[model samples]
Target: ITPASMTIVFLSITIGTIMTMSSSNWLMAWIGLELNMLAILPIISKPKTTRASEATTKYFLTQAIASAMMLLSSTINVWQTGNWNILELKNKFSTTIMALSLMMKMGAAPIHFWLPEVLQGTTLQTALLITTWQKIAPVTLMYMISNNIQPTILVSAGILSMIIGGLGGINQTQLRKMMAYSSINNLGWTITIMAFSPNMALMNICTYIIMTTPIFLMMTNMST
Candidate 1:
């Protein structure tokens, strides 16, 4: 990637996450999510290889679906509540749809079929960003909407993700796939904690980022 493009990508990533984290408005969070999504596609597709191209395509499609869901959920939310406030989510159907959309975006269980494939197809650095930084915006939104999300839904997704993450990793030989499962497992833990304590959810995410960074950095050049 050119220096200019790389700078924009990095800056967009920061802007995207901050937009979601700081915004009380759902549209602002969606904007941030879109910025983050658009920025990462170029970065991951920079490699001059077919796998990179395919990975980028798959990532784009998956995120597009998630983004569409997010937008639809927000639209319904506003229609019902006549408000765009993130915390004003009161409708059961809207809450469920929004929660599921964020879960899919974050690659949570039962809806995480895209994660391993994308992680395996992309370069280590891009995979790192997808597994770590890419989650910030969606997870932040999840926490903000935690109050409205059903406990049963959260617990179901969390347990299923943990099961899949754990079982899926046992038979994986590739490093990235294994790490992808590990990310899924950690996300499960985060979602579970999100049910009872938003602060704990954020703390778990912080700790996961801290621990995963050095490990992925070390694995950057270490092939599968």
Candidate 2:
């Protein structure tokens, strides 16, 4: 890619993520997420291979489904509570839908099937972004609605994620797929603690990034 194009892509991604993180209303958050999703597609498909194209398509479809669910949840909440504020998610059904959508976006639990395939098809740097930076907005949204979502669902998904992540990676030879499973496992821990302690969930995510970054950087340098 040209330098100008790369710069624009990265800037848009950053701005999109920041917008999602800072937005007070669901509409703004949805827009930010869409922008982020669009910005990352080119990066994921940069290799111009069939696998890259497949990965991009899978990522887009999965994210679009999650985003639509999120918007629908917000609409339900607005209908019930007449509020557009993120923190005003008082409707039980909306809260559950919102939580599930965020978990799907973050590649957690039973809905995490797309992550490994997507990571395997992308370059190392793009994989790194998928596992780390792209997670922040969804996690932030989860955190914001932590009080509203049912703890049992979050805890159940978290436990399932940990188990599946561990079992799924045992036979994988591909480094990117292994990292995908690892991210799911770590996210399980974060989501488990999110309902009980939001601060701890944040800390867990921060630590995951710190620990995972070095490994990805080393792998990239070695061309692995």
Best by lDDT: 2
Q: What is the C-alpha lDDT of each candidate?
A: 0.91, 0.95
lDDT of 2 at 37: 95
Candidate 1, pairs of clashing residues: none
Candidate 1 Cα deviation (angstroms), residue 62: 0.7
lDDT of 1 by residue, 111-157 (tens): 89999998988888888899999999899899889988998899889
- After superposition, which runs of candidate 2 have C-alpha atoms over 4 Å from their true positions? none
TM-score versus the correct structure, for each prediction: 0.97, 0.99
Give lDDT for model 1: 0.91
Best by TM-score: 2
Compared with the true structure, model 2 gives a TM-score of 0.99
Clash totals for all candidate models: 0, 0
